[model samples]
Target: MVDLNAALRPADAGSLQPTAARPPARLQIADVSLQYGGKTPTLAIDNVSLEVANNEFCVIVGPSGCGKSSLLYLVAGLTDVTSGTIRVDGRPVHEPGSDRGMVFQGYTLFPWLTVRSNVEFGPRRKGLPKAEYRAIADHFLEEVGLTAFADSYPAALSGGMKQRVAIARALANDPSALLMDEPFGALDSQTRTVMQKLLLRVWEHTQKTVLFVTHDIDEAILLGDRVVVMTARPGKIKAEVPVPFARPRSISLVLEPEFIALKKRILGLLHDEIDETH
Candidate 1:
């Protein structure tokens, strides 16, 4: 929690602003469903309701064919929901915009643009003055440890570095939320580990709300404030497990007795869900 007493502002100088002290559920999904063409008609998701509080690190994990990525798309408004509602900051999500920054697993950085240019893309599209772009882009790049290679092309960087640049680009605009769909799924094992550390550091430095979609159980447990496990197909949330560990956790946290116990429980929950789905 931010120390309100130490935070200075002109309004606080003279009067008190009446605001509820809650992280606030910035993203809310209620009885949502998605349908697509298939012989059996893939439901994608059904009756799924979730709320992500401000600053919460939420990870959605399930089996391979589950609708995790579909859920992210629905949140982004990249695809329309078949039913129910999606809201962010208490407003219904209707279309894609910079209010929510998204990082895809495929590393969508423009091959034509340099890393610096890629990071600046969002700010530039906003028509933010060039004077402001440098600092915003540079700041996030530095956070991702890409300041030295700001001018390097994405093709020239390692897989991990490329993903970091993508993250910096998403964060440069300082969006109210970050939506990620398995953003590190394409990397090598070592690179994925490094990227996970980078993601934690970035989340620490900039406490934007994150909703990450991953199929990896270990990854979900390692990063999520709350891990939402869903059923295999026609997905539905099966369990929501709070990590219960404090922030700045180490990789060794996985080996901790409590962490291991929770992991086993979550696995059993997911197993039951998977069987029901199949």
Candidate 2:
């Protein structure tokens, strides 16, 4: 019998301990709320606050329509918050900027662009020297194991391959934080698992701050330093469960007893929120 409560304890600041010269949070959200205005205003997110440390990987999970994706969009500056603030590296986010890179569930790649071209889009847009941007694209393409497909168009690649290009494209921009919203939601189980491993490898190498949104509890645990659970619609922070596992994690971690205990605990939390809604 594992102590589920103990397993879900808040993460110790072991690796994240701040010093006098430490930088501000890489990503910060304070009292964020999003309400769609109309005859009947609908509040999607309510007073949700979160902070992601530099190089930390945080994942948000919740039931359907819980505004998990909405919160991520607010951070990406794709939608305005009704009230509150979102900051990246101590600067407020007003609109989409090069400082943040977004990857959606859909491939969202330009069909006409080849894999290398798609990855170079951001650097090219920033007026980087063609040679420099091409090098950047080549580097990330290799990182995601897409070097062989560099010249293949998005139409020529499979779903998993397209997403690898999408990730490579996001990282090429060299954003302060990587924001992903269910980026693997469209893939089959086997492909999703492979992408998960690939992403972990790239993330370990880049060490970029990440805020990923997903409903999959297994993924949230496997990929995040902290798993933030949101309440039902009109989402609010339900809990933050720190992952106790050590890094350089492999798929086999999922088979361990500790991982199973944590999953059950988080699943229970989600079930409670769901029950309240009905």
Best by lDDT: 2
Per-residue lDDT, model 2, residue 25, is 78
User: Mind giving the per-residue lDDT tens digits that candidate 1 earns over 1-278?
Assistant: 22222111112111112236436688888889999976877788888888888898989988877799999999998999999899988889989978899999987899999899999999999899998998889898889998899888988998889889989999998888899999999998888988898899889989989999987778887898878878778788766666667789777777876666667777787788667755
The C-alpha TM-scores of every prediction are 0.89, 0.94
Alpha-carbon RMSD of each model:
8.3, 3.3
State in Å the error of residue 91, model 2.
0.8
Q: Can you write out model 2's per-residue Cα lDDT over 1-278, one digit (the tens) per residue? A: 44556557643322334435335678888888999999999999998878788999999998999999988889999999999999999899989999999999987999988889999999999999999999999999999999999998988889999999999999999999999999999999999999999999999999999999998999999999889888899998888787878799998889999899899989998999999989
Indicate the worst ten consecutive residues by lDDT in candidate 1: 7-16
Candidate 2: where is the Cα deviation over 4 Å? 1-6, 10-24
> Between which residue pairs do clashes occur in model 1?
none
